[model samples]
Target: MTVLDIDGIDTYYGNSHVLHDVSLTLAEGEVVALLGRNGAGKTTTMRSIMGVTPPRRGEITYRGEDIVGKAPNEINERGINLVPEDRRVFPTLTVHENIVLAHKLAADPRPVEEMYELFPVLDGLRRSNAQNLSGGEQQMLAVARALVQRPSLLLLDEPTEGLAPVIVDDLRTMLQDVVEQDVTVLLSEQNVTFAFDLATRGYVIDTGSIVFEGSIEEIREREDLLEQYLAVSPEEVA
Candidate 1:
């Protein structure tokens, strides 16, 4: 089943036209990557879906219903969640407090304790301020907070940025667990290997348009495609 269908969306910021006729779709339980370099409109695409930046033209349907002009909270209530690249946890709030806050706001949230099951490291730091946690730990917290809302579709932007490889691996394992829960994901990432690991398919976005869409296997095999868009070699991507 199609969880999301974005058809020829043109998004803008003020008078600046950013996305031009960009389109993509997500099936139920599929992890699709929006691959791009810096300033490549990946986050704009995500923002458009979540209603932060409503597209100027074209259609956006979540579960076959039009959502082009809905508010962010309204869209989120419809079971779509977003984890922004900055890992927007409340700095002064405790780890547990963050989850509690999100839980209270969620339309259909999971139990707060379940977050510990998803990220055991968080269990030990439940009492600590979010700002005190390491970058990776904070990233985990951000993801945990989003998942506590029990969203049907998750829009994750750059979850692996600035992380150590080991932490990325740990996050990958935890997210593997998330994928098994039948959650559909639209992952916006510049971390090719990390994105490749979690995504079944990828859409390469450049300057504001989707240039390539294919299975992970097909994307990996195309060295020229990788270099031209992502600026990575075969070994780095794999």
Candidate 2:
């Protein structure tokens, strides 16, 4: 089943056109990656889906319902959540407090214990303010915040951004568990290897348009494709 569908969306910010005729879909329980460099409209695509930045044209449907003009809260209430690239957590809130806040938003939220269970390191620092947590911890808390709401479609933008290799590895392992649990994810990333590891299929966007999309195997073996679009020519793709 297709969980979310974005067809021919043209999202703009003020007068500047950001996303041009961008279209993609997320199947139920599949991890789809949106690959691109820094300014390739990845975040814009995610924001458009969450309704933070509604598209000026085209249709966005969630489970066969049109959601182009829905408010962000309305969209979120429908079980679609976006963990933005910034990892925006309430800086003053404690780890436990943050999870509780998100739980309150859900009509059917998972227990607060589940967040701790998924992230035991967070359990150890339950009382620590979000500002005090490490970068990786904040990322985990951000993801935990979204997951606690028990969303049907989770939009994760650059989950591996700005962290040490060890933290990234830990996140990858945790996400593998999330995949096993069948959480439908649309991930946007500049980290090619990390995204490829989690995504079976992907769409590559360049300069606000989709340039390539296919199975991971098809994209993985093409060094020329990676090099021309992503400037990632090393053996990192392997």
Best by lDDT: 1
lDDT of 1 by residue, 1-238 (tens): 9999999999999999999999999999899999999999999999999999999999999999999999999999999999999998999999999999999998778999989998999999999999999999999999999999999999999999899999999999999888788589999999898889889999999999999999988999999889999989998866
Among all windows of 10 consecutive residues in model 2, the one with the lowest summed lDDT is 174-183
Per-residue alpha-carbon lDDT of candidate 2 for residues 106-154, written as tens digits (9 for 90 to 100): 9999899988888888999999999999899999999999999999889
- In terms of lDDT, model 1 sits at 0.94
After superposition on all CA atoms, how large is the RMSD of candidate 2? 1.0
Clashes of 2: 0
TM-score for each candidate, following the candidate numbering: 0.98, 0.97
Report per-prediction Cα RMSD to one decimal.
0.9, 1.0
lDDT of 1 at 37: 97
